[model samples]
Target: MEEVAVASDGRALTVGSQQLAHSLFANYPLTAAFLSFALAQTLKVLTTWYKERRWDAKRLLGSGGMPSSHSAAVSALAVAIGFHDGPGSSSFAIALVLACVVMYDAFGVRLHAGRQAEVLNQIVFELPAEHPLADTRPLREPLGHTPPQVAAGAALGLIMAYLMHVTTNLSS
Candidate 1:
């Protein structure tokens, strides 16, 4: 059975557990990343709701928010790998490098692409109704993650990894 630990704020950590739930509980790093991404999407929906005072199904799929989900997930995975495999481990190194690349793309290339899409969408929206381009709709390309979003994700992942490691150690 894996040992479970709780933080002052009630967060949990575990190394490994025989029970399915407990075993799954140990994988907090990955879960945290996903939760962060979900939070960003939810925020976008809320923002839209506030502006329009109405529900927008499109916001659910819209990208770009306080934190980048992609960055969060990959960074969390890297942090988890680092914790599990050791900083110097080849697996951890690979994961860390991959995470960096992913974050860079999300904040740099993908972000610019989103901006380009936005400008293009604006142009499309301004087209005259009688123009053939009037039928072209704006694509919902995401603005990707910001540097702070990526950094926050990295922090969250590291914290989760550490907590998991500590709990596993204490439980044993």
Candidate 2:
């Protein structure tokens, strides 16, 4: 079978390797998700190292990092959809709405919940030592997005989308 080669940020791959170009194009959104998640994890690790001068394993699994990974993924998808489907298209509109809801939840509702959890955990810790199950550890809830965190995530997502467009010659 003949394959058409396309060059990306240094990588070369054959086009039309999949059932359809659309299927292959859909990878943009998926890549955005993975990139966001990895970036968030990396940020947490880097932040921990900066603060304590050590690589803390726990930071890798912790939430509420410098940039909100959740924001990055959603914003990336939204931006991709807008680019692919046209900003006025129904698909883009839906994605935009979903992104707004997700960001709001991360910054507003979920953040509050995490703070509440922290308070609850503190209270639990202060309980009398004689009580049943007194040895149980307090719950740690991580929440809230600092403005800088959200901005960083948004910038990351937008940059990724733009880079994909430029490198892939993707219309978006």
Candidate 3:
């Protein structure tokens, strides 16, 4: 979506398109990002239920799952930006770069952090009841995504963004 500018008369100005004019959700790129994130998180719940044979409602809002919501959201934003502004546009470039960084961190830095947390939690579990640091709360163990999770997220994002673009253009 094009940037909304401030009008001389103080009204918010937007470039007119069918999406901006008639749609309840006016911000196309942001909407795509948010929808992708929601879908990925919801899928996490389903995936957990399938694998564990028990429903896990908390997966709807938790990190580290079958598909990384962070990756999904960012990739969707990047794809939507590319669709709206053209791949060569600055907005698309920024979004693409942001997506790359987020996915990379999800697979590398955050994954390592989660692994370290698991190890630390094990160590803490072995400590004597009287040890000073033994009482610390266990660190979260699912702070990142595996490579397959990230890949799934990215794929989901692309599909979602494409769908959003198609719908918007068709409605135009």
The candidate that achieves the highest TM-score relative to the unseen native structure: 3
Better of 2 and 3 by lDDT: 3
Q: Compared with the true structure, what per-residue lDDT tens digits does model 3 show for residues 9-37? A: 69987765654554537779999999999
Residues 1-172 of candidate 1 have per-residue lDDT tens digits of 6777675469986645465465455565555556555655565577667877987777666667645656666776777777776889887788889988988988898888988898999998988999998899687677776788677656655665566667767887
- Candidates' lDDT values, in order? 0.70, 0.73, 0.92
Off by over 4 Å in 2: 1-26, 170-172
Reference-based TM-score, model 1: 0.68
Worst 10 residues of 1 by lDDT: 15-24
Which predicted model would earn the best lDDT?
3
RMSD of 1: 8.4
lDDT, candidate 2, 22-134, per-residue tens: 55545776676667767776887888789889987776667776677777877887887776668898877887898788778877887888889888887778889997756
Give the lDDT ranking, best first.
3, 2, 1
TM-score for candidate 2, please give it.
0.76
Error of model 2, residue 161, in angstroms: 1.2
- lDDT of model 1 at position 74: 73
